[model samples]
Target: MIENPGILFSVLAFLCAIGPLVFIHEMGHYTAGRFFGIKADAFSIGFGREIAGWTDRLGTRWKIGWLPLGGYVKFAGDMNPAGVPDAAWLALPAAERERTFQAKPLWQRAIVVAAGPFVNLALAVLILAGFAYAYGVDRTPPVIDQVAAGTPAAAAGLAPGDRIVAIDGVAMATFSDLAKFALIRPGQAVAVTVQRDDRRQAMPLTIGTVRQRDRFGNEYRIGRLGIAGGKPVYAPVSLIEAPLAGVRATAEIVSGTVETLGQIISGRRSIDELGGPIRIAKVSGEQMSLGWPAFVWLLALLSINLGFINLLPVPLLDGGHLLFYAVEAVRRRPLEPQAQEWAFRGGLAAVLLLMLVVTFNDLGAVGVWQRLAGLIG
Candidate 1:
């Protein structure tokens, strides 16, 4: 088991990071429902027994629960979470029927339900922009901070503080460019020009073999250098540039996700890389240990993930509900209860199965289950 302060910090970071994201998501539903004249019975963050709660004049219960996993906003007529089906409430009096969710116009219902995921997406974009504004955009500069002990640069006698003047005969400008070059050639040799000790020199170095794993069981490959570069400073941009930064960051993340998914589908990437909450928790802990900045960045990444996952077309999720709303919009009526129920059941199964697989993968990656088995043996 991981017992470092890093792990504990990560656990806290995970909660702190997700707590507000969930709240914002629920708030979206609450806001839209209120706008459409639908009363909300309760707005609660987390699940299980309530830790703190207060009732509003509107007779709504707003509470904070002990669990930090997620939250929900219950509508006045929701009855059960999925909302009472139309036929079941037909026998109720007219006044009572008015409060029921099924009685609302399909468009209104769709807006209320879809609001949660939409809020998440909006939060991601805003956060990205905020990060960019605060940190300024990181541009690639052709500088080598330090080369790995057994990396190609190390073998070629490259030392720390060597600024790469050029790569592959092309003028180098940023660390990003150097990073891209390194990533592209995992085991290939390349010519590099560096300024070391007020002198310029050219060297041919073969990228080192992949070391793959470290003492902590973490895996990373070296570029055959004994030293790497220090942090190179970049000029911060004005607030006006923040939104553009956010858009670019969001686009990059979305593009990367799409590419990764494609790679997985095409067998270029392994399914073993899929991780669940366990992996996230571990990573969160490690990042938190690194410092506040790392922790905050992790929070932003997780927020984006939460938003992305909630948009998947799985019944019981925000996306699944939206899908049903689309169907109703076209058909001019809700789908049959039997069909909806079945779809929900399938979705539930799929989600649970995915969680299980991801959990297993996470534990395996962390060597937790293996250690446990070894102890038993």
Candidate 2:
């Protein structure tokens, strides 16, 4: 049992991190379905054979699956966990059909499909709000305190006393803002507006790129502006203001994520940076070791990512379902069954391919290939 605490912690930490998030995500769908008078056949966490569960008063079979990867709430008419409509169920009488998800109006179906991801996003915002209320918010100004030699800031003619006013005309209110803006735009040129001698001057600067490794040896390729900010100052956030602060913080995270994806798509960033379950488990365990605060913070960040990813327009994902619903709304009818079948098949393939790529990346990051090579040698 004591053979490897790290592996044990990683497994446990992964469960702890993923379990509730999945529960909440499925719960969102369940609650929304119930609100529309739709029946849920089952609520299962993870994906395979049942581990344990109980039937609810509403007749929903609440179960835990052996696979701890993800969970789903099966509605009355769902063919499977992916929420495909059962053709036989759809052929039922009108009175029976009223209680099924597909029988609902287009708008209601859209809301039901969207509720899960929105709930995840809302959960993240609340988590951030709690942190802001507890520890306050950073109010540090974006004034340059240092410019490292042989760096972008040095090349851009930035000086220590210069006060950063904006980047490409977007006002930089805080040092955090500046950092967030730069972090997602590595190797991109931007106009930096700085206030010097009571005058503002905009100068073109190319962001630098750097590869860094964490304590756990996970690699990251991020932007570096090569300038340091003045000492930070944090102001206490009141209860009323905390939610707004949380929203702003959440927006920054969303913006950064979007920018990073854009960079990856544009070939400005490496696809190797994508991570999967293994990397998440490793990081989750490391954060758990640090303390609850760190772990909880990771939870919030992951929650946001989960919400964002599910919104992508790919079949088998929440976003894909929404996309289909959108087409139904526009065409005034659902897509043909054959078309949907093929779309879902394609979506499944895409999702599986992505999982394979990220898993390969995770293995490489953990040096699994190196260890195997060493053994072979």
> Each prediction's Cα lDDT score?
0.74, 0.89
Inter-residue clash pairs, candidate 2? none
- For candidate 2, lDDT tens digit of each residue in 1-377? 22233978998999999999999999999999999999999999999999899998989999999989899888888865445457687688888778988778889888988999899999999999999999999999898999999999999999998999999998999998888888777788999999998898999999998888766666677788999988889999999999998889888899889988887788877888889999899888888888889899999999999899999999999999999988888998888777888899999999999999999988987789989999999
Point out where model 1 deviates above 4 Å.
Answer: 1-7, 80-84, 91-96, 139-217, 220-235
Put down candidate 1 lDDT per residue, 111-157, tens digits, no spaces: 88878877776777788888878878777455666566655677887
TM-score of 2: 0.95
Supply the global lDDT for candidate 1.
0.74
Off by over 4 Å in 2: 1-5, 80-87
User: TM-score for all predictions?
Assistant: 0.74, 0.95
